[model samples]
Structures are given as C-alpha cells and as structure tokens.
Target: MKGISENMYCSDCGKKVKDGADICFNCGKEIPRGINKYITAENLPEEYKPISMWGYFGYQILFAIPIIGWIILIVYAIGGAPNINVRNFARSYFCFYIIAATLLLIVYLS
Candidate 1:
C-alpha cells in the first residue's frame, strides 16, 4: 500500500483510520503523522535564509530512487529548514527536503 489504504484498520481501537490522520478520531489513538504534522503551513518560517534555495527543486528531481532515496526524503522533510526567525515552515520544509536529497544522492552515488 502506498499510503494508509481504505482497508487499513486502526492498530489501537480496531476501527478504520482515515487517510492522513494525526490521531484516530474514533479512538483518539495517536497515529504517526507525516513531516507536515509537526507544524502547519501558517506557522512555518517566513524566509529561506538557512534553507538552501536549491533544496526543494533538487528533491523533486531525485525522488524517483528506491527505498533509500525515499527514506532520505522523509528525513529531510522532517528536519525542516533554517529560518531567519519568522518561522517560515513551508520554506524550512522545502529546504530540508532539498538538502537531504542532495546529501543522499551524494552518498549513494559515491
């Protein structure tokens, strides 16, 4: 299953967990959320100071690699990008993804 499928059942309450859920609404069990779960779009930093400008675009270009590549991408997405202090969540997320992808590619290719 590429993602939480419709057939999937909640591990906690045995009820079905909806796709992209942070918690099982039916049982209140904490489900593993994605990278975006840590912060909302509105709460992210404002500029791309620490987040490399080349990062996001780079990840998109490398996303096709198997297991390791995807794993690295997730890590990047989770680490977030550096901020100028305004808390630019989206920019941080993009930068993290980019930087992680670049590093992963470098490591894997060598």
Candidate 2:
C-alpha cells in the first residue's frame, strides 16, 4: 500500500496505469509489483537487522588497536562472528589493512 497509488505509473515511461493491471497501457512495460523498491532493515527478514551505531564504532575501535586487533579481525572475517553484517565488516576492514600495509611496504622498500 505504501508504494502503491490510486493510479499506478509505469516506472520506465511515467504513464498512468490502471489498478490491478500488470502491464502499462501507454508504454507496454510490465507494471512492477512489490519489486524495485528500497527495503529497509525493518522490512528485512528476522535473521537480519541493521547494525547499530555503537556496534559499528565498537568494531572500529577494536580494529584500531594493534596485534590483538588483527587477531580479532581474522576471527570475525573467517565467520567467527554470528552476525553476517559484522562478518562482512571485519572482512572488509581486514582487506583495508592488508592493502594499506602493502602500500606502506612498497614505499618503504622503494
């Protein structure tokens, strides 16, 4: 009901479409139903919820520390973390560190 309107419009050509219609009369494009819409965390299935601000910052802080930070990153990146979001974040963060370290090494060796 949120994305639906009294008179639906074809997203491709912006032509008015009739209710319960599958295809646009003017454009002949299929009228999208419950698709091509932004799905927020609230709309997502129960297994996933958007990461909280504090949890994000906490991971950032953990990654900032030396030695133990790398260990934690490796653990999470390897799927030790229960949350998919956290696992992905850790993997990306570890990749960033690896790239940064490689760049520094290249500069130092040069």
User: Taking the tens digit of each residue's C-alpha lDDT, what string does model 2 give over 1-110?
Assistant: 46433455688888876665666788789856565343444445333566899989999999889999888889989988778898899999998998999999999999
TM-score of model 1 vs. true structure: 0.29
- Which ten-residue region of model 2 has the weakest summed lDDT? 36-45
User: What's model 1's overall lDDT?
Assistant: 0.55
Clashing pairs in 1: 44-87, 44-88, 44-89, 45-87, 45-88, 45-89, 46-88, 55-98, 81-92
How many clashing pairs does model 1 include? Answer: 9
**Candidate 2: C-alpha lDDT:** 0.77
Question: Model 1: C-alpha RMSD to truth?
Answer: 15.1
Model 2 misplaced stretches (Cα beyond 4 Å)? 1-47
lDDT, candidate 1, residue 12? 75
How far in Å is the alpha carbon of 74 misplaced in model 1? 24
lDDT of 1 by residue, 1-110 (tens): 34523344568798876555566789888766452233444434354334455754565555446666556555545554244421344345457768998999999999
Model 2 residue 80 CA deviation in Å: 0.3
